[model samples]
Each structure stands twice: as C-alpha cells, then as structure tokens.
Target: MKTIKSILGILVAALFVNTAIAGTPSAKKATTLAVDTKESKIHWLAKKVTGQHEGTIAISSGSLITSGAKVTGGSFVIDMKSIVCTDITDAEYNKKFIGHITTGDFFEVEKFPTTTFKITKVAGSNITGDLTLHGVTKSITFPAKITVAGGKTTATASIPVDRTEFNVRYGSKKFFESIGDKAIDDVFTLDVTLVAGK
Candidate 1:
C-alpha cells in the first residue's frame, strides 16, 4: 500500500508540473510600432566604370508589427523624390546628379514617387519581403540585425538591389550592349537603418 501511494504521489507531482508548464503564457501579445521616419535612413551606392555615386533616400513613413521581442512583420515607404547625391561636393554637380537619378533615365521619380517594402516572413534575424521600386515589385530575402530594448526597436540590413530587375537600366550594359566602359553595375547596395517606438 505504501509503494502504491508513493507511485501515485510521484504521478500527481509530475501531472502538476506538466499542468503548470502548459498554463504559463509564452509571451506578450503583438504590438504595432510607428517607425521614426526622421531617424531611419537608407543609403544607396551605385557604381559605374569611372566611379560611383552614393546617396540616401528618405523614409516617409512605416510601421513594425512585433510580438514580444520578435519582429513579426512591417512595411515602409521611401520617398523617391528625396534622393540626394552625397558623393559630389560641387553643389551644381550634386544637383545635376540628383536630377538625373530622379528623371526617366533612372528611378523615374516623377511617375513613381514612392517605393515600399512589405515584410512577409521573418525567421530569426532574416527577413523576406516584397520590395517595390520603379513600379515593379519583387520578392527579396536579406539578413538583418533586429533588437528591442528600452521601449525602442532598431533594425539594420544591407541589401544589394539589381537595377535591371526593376527596369532601371539606363547605364546598364545588360540592356545596352554597346555602352563600353561607361556601363554601370546592375547591382547597387543600400544600407538600411530603421528605428521605431511602441
């Protein structure tokens, strides 16, 4: 009888532990945050045979949907018209380069004034989403470092975007075969910095 009671007590203890484990909440509910457009920045680098031009495009608005400390999903819009040339010190030349980029030859900012990225999936620090630029949308996956602390969240990612894929082929040799050394690299790099608050 004592042996049976000991066995039953152990079983009861095990069942109690299992019940407590199952009843405990995993984490808090998801929260939607508004990204600070003024604080977030996107820097772009486009390379050519002679040299390269680097600049930044501003984030107009965005939001991040996070669950506890994990970024579940989000979307952000970029102001294409905010394209600035940071490489050129000459004011006139910088203005010209900025104009050219926003013109029909490159981004066609007059027609497509905004670009966006919508996160669809996030696994660990890697995010997969749809990026829309120049009126063309494509799915892209990139690694990012995301952190949440002190009521603020920050995410940073380095993305290499191929201009030809989005039909921005002004100086690309892939489209104009006879361009020679003046050809620009099809792929460009964008260093992204995002900051948001609850």
Candidate 2:
C-alpha cells in the first residue's frame, strides 16, 4: 500500500511538470515590413546665398525590421533621377537648373545615380544611420518621430546633411573662397516620411 502511494505521487508530480512545460509560451520573432514606396515620401531642401530650392525625391525600395511595436532596423534607396524642383515653375529654366545639378557641378547623377541610408541604431527619438551619397558613406544621427501600430509603421525626420562630406563641393563656401553671393550652404535638409507594412 505504501509503495503504491509513493508511485502515484511521483506520477502526479511528473504530469504537473509536463503540463507546466507545455503551457509556457515561446519567444516572439522579429518581422520584416516592406516599405510602401507609393505612400512614403522624401522632400529635400537646399540653400544657397540667394535662396533655397525645395524638391521631392523618390524612393526605389526599402524595408524595416521590427520586433513587436518597436522599430529595430531599416534601409532606403533614393532614386537620384527622380529629383524634381517643385519651387521652379519655368520649364526652360527648370530644365537648365536640373541639368546643372545633375551634371558634374552638383550630385553628378550620371556617375553616382542612387543614394542610400541604412539605420544603424534607434534609441528613444534619435536615429543613427549610415548615409551613402555621391560615392561616399557617412554615419549621421538625427531626431525622428517613429510610430508602430496595426501592423504598420510610420517615421518622419528632418535631417540636416552637409553635402561637402559626401564630396558634393560645388558652390560651398567651405571649399571655395571669395565667392560671396554665389556660395551655397554646405548643409542641406531632408524631410523624410516613411511608411511600411508587413
């Protein structure tokens, strides 16, 4: 009778252990969300001694990696050829201006056609990324507002980039001297809005 009671207690304890193991949940894995190219937008603002030019640029492709509601990583490819000056209305002058920028003077679109930004770290409201532009890559940190909800993520940031760091030295006063009114500001701003979904 005593042996049987001991055997029954051991079996019950084993069963309880198995049940607890089976009820434990597994760890959740990270998910990749593809960027919605149609909904995402990147606007660029460049300044010179005279005035500023605001334009829109297209994203070629990208994706964001997320774990639960937090954004982990992402990258974006900018289509250099899609640059358009929204503030310029004259067709002839617009064409000339675009040509001047796309040619050897600035950007040199013929040689380096695309730009890319890859996220390295995201902490709080700050994002650090490696920006590859004009055949050069540089790591930059900027503040951004990011939100994840309902299987989608939206991010917006106003990033200021010094064009001279990427070898775009056209009319920058940092490189050229005595060019008072013709000198362009080295820093250009990029206002980006990225939308991604699973």
Candidate 3:
C-alpha cells in the first residue's frame, strides 16, 4: 500500500510538470508590434549629374507582425513634408531644395503629403511589398535584415524606386531628351531602419 501511494505521488508531480511546460508561451507565437516611429527613419537619395541630394524622412506610423525572428508582414507611413536635405549645407539652399522637391517637380507633397509601404509576403530576409507614392502603387521586392532580441525587434532594408513609375517626370531622363547632365536619375534609393518593441 505504501509503495503504491509513493508511485502515485511521483506520477502526479510528473503530470504537473508536463502541464506547466505545455502552458508556457511559444517562442514562435504570432506577434504584432507597433513600429517605433521615434526610433525609425528612412534615408532618401536622388542622383543628378551635378551630384546627389540625400535627406532623412520621418515615419508617421506603422507596425510589424512577426513570428519568432521572421517578419511576417509590416507597413510604414512616410512623412513627405518631413523631407530634409543634408547635402546642401546652406540653410537657404537646403530650404529651397526642400521646397522644390516637395512641389510638382518632384514628390508633390502638397497633393500627396505621405507615402506608404505595405508588406505582402516575406521569405527569410527578402520582402515583397506594395509601395505607394504620389498616389501610385507598385509592387517592389527588397532584401531586409530582421532580428529579435530581448523582446525588441529591428529591421533594416534598402529599396530603390523609379520615379517615372509614380508619374514623377520632373528631370527624369526617361521622359525628356537633351536634358543631359541636368537630368535626374529615375531611380532613387530609400534606406530604412525600423524598430519595434513588444
């Protein structure tokens, strides 16, 4: 009788241990994280024969969904009015540069004050998303590095977008002839870094 009681107690303890293990949260549980706008930014560059202009753009709001370290999906809002020119050191020239780029000659910020990128699919570090700018949306694929640690997640990606696709003619070489060195490259790159906290 004593031996049977001891055996039952051991089995009960083992059952409780298994139950606890099963109740624990999974590491790969689907998680939706808000994009940390304060800690995220997009760097933009457009090249011309004279050189190039680079600036930082602010993220208005966004979110990232993840499973473990894999970025399942995400979307970001770019604040076009927040565009600033870092190449032009002079304050006046920088302001002029900003003003011109925000006009119809470039991004047309007044008409479309914001741009967005929404992820449709993701494979490892490669992400396919729809980017909307100037009210035109197109699918774009890019490579990104995503990592999760200490309950925080970060992602870095670079995307090159063609201005002509979004009807941004401006000084694009594709739309006009004889523009020569005055023409701007149709492709502009956006280097993005995003952070999200659980």
TM-score of each: 0.89, 0.86, 0.85
lDDT by residue (13-46, candidate 2, tens digit) is 9999999999998866888899999999999999
Highest-lDDT candidate: 1
* lDDT assessment of candidate 2: 0.92
For each candidate, what is the lDDT? 0.93, 0.92, 0.91
- What does candidate 2 score in Cα RMSD to the true structure? 3.1
Please provide, for model 1 over 6-92, each residue's C-alpha lDDT reduced to its tens digit, 9 standing for 90 to 100: 999999999999999999988778899999998899999989999998989899999999888789999999999898888899999
Residue 24 lDDT in model 3? 100
By TM-score, who's the top model here? Answer: 1
Query: For candidate 1, which ten residues in a row score worst on lDDT?
Result: 93-102
The 10-residue segment of model 3 with minimum total lDDT is 172-181
Clashes of 2: 0
Candidate number with the higher TM-score (1 or 3): 1
By lDDT, the better pick of 1 and 2 is: 1
Query: Clashes in model 3: which pairs?
Result: none
Tell me the alpha-carbon RMSD of every candidate.
3.2, 3.1, 5.1
